[model samples]
Target: MDTRTRFAVSAALTLGLLAGCGDDAAPAGSAAGDPAPQATGEPWYDEVTPASASGTTGGAGSPCPVPVSFPLADGWTAKAIEPPKGELAELLGEALTKRGGTTARCEVDGRPAGGGFLRVWAADTPTVAPRAALEGFAAGSGETVSGQQFRDLRAGSFDVTEMTWLATNPLAEEEAARNWALAVQSAGQTLVFAVNEGLITERTDVLPAYRLAVRGLAAPG
Candidate 1:
């Protein structure tokens, strides 16, 4: 597989690992007195997590450093994750770190984690145009439906570009889903955040969450 294809596949698995599928009708989180309902059957990769079961929006534990810290929308649980490693690490180059919305439902590799995924890295382009950076990244993210469509928007004082696409998960064969990404130039680096709604089952609309994350984007003190 080529670079984009590899990136896309890796990302898909990462998502799957975060968003585990299930048949239980129970919501994502359990009530204080209620325990999380047991799944009726094996968790599928394409299970649709209900919006009511959505995650809490906020940082976990301590505050993260600049380029990593950003305010998340409500119904999201955001926190840092280990960086990409080995080949994935080499491919990203110039240092790459990750943060995820653990409660956001974007399932990959059978893992049901969260909806929003964030990556901030050293800029690899001479121009700082967010669209260019977003598109460039998408181009290498394997074969996308009609490639990546982009739009302009504002995230605080920063101008932001959002891109969306339907990406095929080659490893999973029959599975595909809608994916969206936001790119912003901040603190002399490029910040990219993305979310996915699997196509195999009903998809979730996470535009609001994505936009909220954009507004929260900021530089560290």
Candidate 2:
């Protein structure tokens, strides 16, 4: 099988294992305000291994640093890329296409998430507004979504917003829900994007590393 297929299979298996563990809700004290105590040593997750060219390129400008962090899971990987453009749905569609994935725009809680390209476009390009998007996305998923915003993190030549998403996985009920975070910044006409997932079921514990990775991004002029 191809590398992408392998990655997808691994992700599916991991999700399955997490789903099988009943009461996947993160242990108590994992809320946005109650972040886990900082560890003095190395991050919990391992560094990302490099991958071969995937026909993807960085967005037009450099990525600004955002203050976020998360533990990198074993055997998992992460990569930085340019944020999607065009209408929100179009952009999402394009990105997913690169991964052989498909996406649709639908509503979340009477608000739009699936096809709300305009909302995203008007807000700001390459900005990290996961809360806004998740509010709608979660409502659509029928899962309660909650998170906090880390504001004013400056990296490179852009300002960034770092937000975390906490929700129960509707499809993988036992997978401790899914905790994901993203760092977004705008540069020139391009948006810088980075994402980290499967680190911890709790948003607070995983955000620091997510923030760190965002801050570390350097986009070329």
Candidate 3:
């Protein structure tokens, strides 16, 4: 039980509640000057989100300060997240905020695109490789993770390790769900960008925007 992401298993129950949120219809309001959609043939899903770059985050003026900067899709928003404070909060924070050897730094809400989130998690270890960070992230899942497929993906000029896997939840109507994550490096930290398929959202709903951001990842140039 300690090996799984307890929170993820419980989240699957709400998947149906977010049904239809992943429609292939492209979101409007993308800035005309922003980068265009960069699609990948991998992780093949029926409808790719035609999300355009609304803006970017993680650089100086961005809402959330992270090790890396990535594009934000239209209809999505970004915000910084923090763990709870106080003595009792410290214990809860460990469970709520920290996972897979990383702490959540930025959360890109894709409710307009897919009811889920593209969360960025960062670790203190600057030298940690991408694969190891993703492994920790999967290990942190409360549900049973399997069918993991790992590969090399390019994010801007950087090389990243990407992983796609299936998570099982006994409580959900759809017992098996898909999830994706990628790890990249910055100055003194290892950052993991991931989207979990649960908690009122499905993979299809959020992946378009996720892919857009992943393809747009950069070293805050």
Candidate 4:
């Protein structure tokens, strides 16, 4: 699949590549004692180090008109995505950019770095609460979502509502993958910082980058 198509979330592409598609079993070749899913249903925290590099996005000179600015990890490139013109193109654009009740404004691509994307999605209504916005997003993601967990946390100076879950679609019904998003209110907008990948990589390779962004989340001052 093209990079753009692969980068589109589960709501946009049914391909089992990313954006929450899951697998029922771990990949075939396993070491003697690999970690398995926890009985408590918590997210499997991998042992990778947090990304050690950074650039910024979501400011005046940034590529996207996002509500917040955060670190872009090493090898990830951020891009502002414009809605397509013309009616028919607009329809497809909506599908590619919109999820639940929010629309993706920017994507921090990690494919070149051997990972997925850190997408910035925004809600239409500023009045929506962060938790509600996140719930709507999970429900509308067009995947068989399960093992959802939600919590409140502080990232930079902003209060964040974060959700993690396992999801899959018809194309990847057996390989349900873990995914996450964080919602925050900033600059009169409700924005979601999502770590989305659908590729067949061992251990979602972008989690360190996602964690880095979440750790540095800030309003676009």
Compare the candidates by lDDT and give the number of the best one. 4
Model 4 agreement with the true structure over 127-202: per-residue lDDT tens digits: 7998789878887877778877665656776777777777776554256767879898887889888875466553
Instruction: Provide the global lDDT of candidate 2 against the true structure.
Output: 0.30
Rank candidates, TM-score, best first: 4, 3, 1, 2
Better of 1 and 2 by TM-score: 1
lDDT by residue for model 2 (38-78), tens: 22222222132222221211322212122222222222233
- Quote model 3's TM-score: 0.74
Score each candidate by Cα lDDT. 0.43, 0.30, 0.66, 0.68
- Which ranges in model 1 have alpha carbons more than 4 Å from their true place? 1-64, 83-122, 125-127, 145-147, 170-172, 199-205
RMSD of each: 12.8, 13.1, 8.8, 8.3
User: What TM-score goes with each of the models?
Assistant: 0.51, 0.36, 0.74, 0.77
Q: Residue 90 error for model 3, in Å?
A: 2.9
User: What's the CA error at residue 103 for candidate 1, in Å?
Assistant: 22
**What is the model-wide C-alpha lDDT for candidate 3?**
0.66
Per-residue error for 125 in candidate 4, Å, reads 1.4
**Two-way lDDT contest, 1 vs 3, winner:** 3
Candidate 4 C-alpha error for residue 124, in Å: 1.3
Clash counts per candidate, in order, are 26, 22, 5, 12
For residue 91, give model 1's deviation from the true position in Å: 10
